[model samples]
Target: MTTTASYEQLKLLKQFIDESKTIIFYGGAGTSTESGIPDYRSKHGVWTAMTRDGFDPVKYANPQFIKKYPEKFFAKNEERDNRPVPEPNATHKILANWEQSGKDVRIITQNVDGLHQKAGHRYVLELHGHHRLWHCMSCQREYLSEEVKRDEDNIPRCFVCEGIVRPNVVYFGENASKDTVGKARRSMKAADLLIIAGTSLTTPLAKRLIYDFEGDKIVVINLNEVNISPLKADLFIQDWVGEVMTTLSEMN
Candidate 1:
């Protein structure tokens, strides 16, 4: 279902980027699909696969579940931690390049993979938190994911205080970090251009933050239709995010 963008459309996109001084790139899981990461809500995504296997991500990926069943929680996290690391794709590289070229670019992403940082983007706001960061619940001591995974027990314990060690991600019942949200909101509101890419716009947080954008131009790049009512995109391209962004990067 991927469609090719016309030459005129590509020119217009480049024009938008060139004319804007401040830009914000808001992205989702689909942004990293080209890097071998699976999105959550797509037809062949992690959610569908997990559901098919009788694993309820909604129930298990929650704070209450972690508190009630620490062993099960750690088991699931261990599985996640063992997955191969994904590399940055074209979109990530392009955005990082834009920032390096002094385009005043910032990224606000729902992904926890940290690919943006790997691509050398310094101003990234991760709304969902990162899997690679862990902390001791009791001592508030920070630990790398590898450190926690080294534990022999199913439930990871802090070496310092024998307290439970948990990922710094925002679970289903937990709220996102207020500092991150506030910074993202300010960036969106102050941006002259906003690019919404690789997302279906399904999450409430994504929608809410996007609505705060007071930008003059909005561009959406996704293979599927996005229905962000009242806040329509100036340009909507139904295509692969990496493809479109790669093309954009090539333009003058």
Candidate 2:
């Protein structure tokens, strides 16, 4: 159901890319959709389905929930467990290629999927924690993706202290650390061009960060026009991110 960018838009995007120096990419779930990851706010997103079933997905993702009800917090949902592992697509690859080519390019992502890193981007600031990280609530010991074990209840436990293990991601009730937010803000402040892709601007923090950028060009590429309406971006392209980025990369 998605489409590619038009010729005019592609030409315009390429012009912006060629002119800018310090470029920063602000991305969300949509950035990963080309690799088979679903956006969390979409009609078929994880949060959407949970909300339809009368469950507040954010509450379940909260750190407070884990503190209050460790059992329920650690309870495994088959849906989350069975989520398809996605690879980085053209957008991620193109951005990484830009960074590798000595451009002052940085990535600020709201996704925890780690696809950007997998795509070989070195300067990625993950606003949300990664899914692969597991840490002990008590000792604060970190566990790799393979080290953690699940119990009969599917609750992950720490190997050393037998304490509850939690994902490193930021939940709805919890705000990102000041350091993390500061890093993202710094990148925005330095950017000559800001490319926002695949996000609906639903998160207040994301909106604040985007508006805070005093950049030369603010470009938004997405699959829908509705998400970018309030943005007032210098350039708005309603198309698949990977397609647009691929075309831009080729032109560059």
Candidate 3:
């Protein structure tokens, strides 16, 4: 059931890309790492474990907990806001060009960095939301990231209502956005070639989106193996994202 040789597999992938009018890219943390973004779940990532008030810090900042002790919620999450900025890398640039070329139809990503949009891909589904927003729960107000620096507080409170402000990215306990999920499904359904790249697919929500792809060719591109063997995947390449994308970009 497999191709005769590795050469055939790569050729098939490039051929599929050439043929498909609709392409959907489902990406993960590794997608943005070339841009200097820290993948918080990766081995090299910085954020991990801590405990506060006898609860796992991750759990304590969820919407439910934020509704309760917002001061601590904002306190715990300020790090995400203060994270160093990352710009678009080769992988992101190649995809952006693909979008402009009308080959790439949409991007569905688990990253909150907004790198895809930054690289000039206009249509993106951010399953985890974006870090560019600073949101205030009390006033239901939102501000750009730069605006927060001027505010004289560590865990900034809303000037209107003194409610806690947190970055807008999705947390562990929250459901994936229904709009993102539904749109992702439709994109996958319409795609002739679906590329699952720069993703371990280990985390929540992303694996589900991969399952939604019933396209002609399913490709998994990552630097390492993943836990679930993709049922529909026709090819798996353990290569760094930018290297592979730069290769793929030349197949035009």
Candidate 4:
């Protein structure tokens, strides 16, 4: 069951949302769990691949892995492509709503799934790049999701140059795009309120970003431990993101 913070904390969060003009949202895989996407380090998350599937993503989805086992790398991505496509759930919807309501809301997400864009959010910075898009290494031509999926061998190639196409997602040993990083930092610096949800803040990047926030209010919503100290958050809501967002929407 998802846990909820005390009434006082909820009240404080509501007030923060009401008062803040600029809000920055930083989300992780947990943000999409309600949409059927598994998180990376959770109990049954993708990181469990070692025990569950006999191959960890670190070994299968890395740049070195792609160099050594191209077929296996594409096959793994093919499996991911075959999984049910997930739609944005309550959390995504609420955030989108805030954007539509003329709130200066910007999202910085670690998820590669384009759920935020699908949810009608316009200004989203994808820290992990995109999952449904790919580019040919030789020609740099982009391929749509369908075009990439049409390959029988699972290894997509450029139609124009026959160059190997690779997913835009960040593999192990890769850093996020410099452009994305700069924008995220600028957004956080400009935000009057920082809303972090569905992340454990385990990654160095996540910790650094949150710790650098100069926002007036910092709200953390999560079902699991976020690694951030409770003292750092103006309001810490321990709950499913979907549940919390739905309740907040209703309260508005």
The C-alpha TM-scores of every prediction are: 0.93, 0.91, 0.83, 0.92
Clashing pairs for predicted structure model 3, backbone only: none
Assess candidate 4 and give its lDDT: 0.82
Q: Which regions of candidate 4 deviate over 4 angstroms?
A: 1-3, 149-151, 229-231
Tens digits of lDDT, candidate 4, 163-184 = 7788888878889899999888
Q: How would you encode candidate 1's per-residue C-alpha lDDT over 1-252 as one tens digit per residue?
A: 344988788899999999999999999987999988889988888878878889798997887777678887777666765778788998999899989988899999999999999999999999999978898878989998777743566888888888888889987878899999999999999999999998987878988998999989999988888988899889998889988988777777
Best by lDDT: 1
Assess the local accuracy of residue 217 in candidate 2 as a C-alpha lDDT between 0 and 100: 88
RMSD to truth, every model: 1.7, 2.2, 4.5, 2.0
lDDT, model 4, position 146: 67
Quote model 2's TM-score. Answer: 0.91
User: Which candidate model has the greater TM-score, 2 or 4?
Assistant: 4
* Candidate numbers, best TM-score first, in rank order: 1, 4, 2, 3
Off by over 4 Å in 1: 1-3
Name the candidate, 1 or 4, with the larger TM-score value.
1
Cα lDDT tens digits, model 3, 80-161, are 5566766799888888887887766688898888888889998899988876897887787997766653244456666667
Number of residue pairs clashing in candidate 3, backbone atoms closer than 3 angstroms, sequence gap of 3 or more or interchain: 0
What's the lDDT for candidate 2? Answer: 0.82
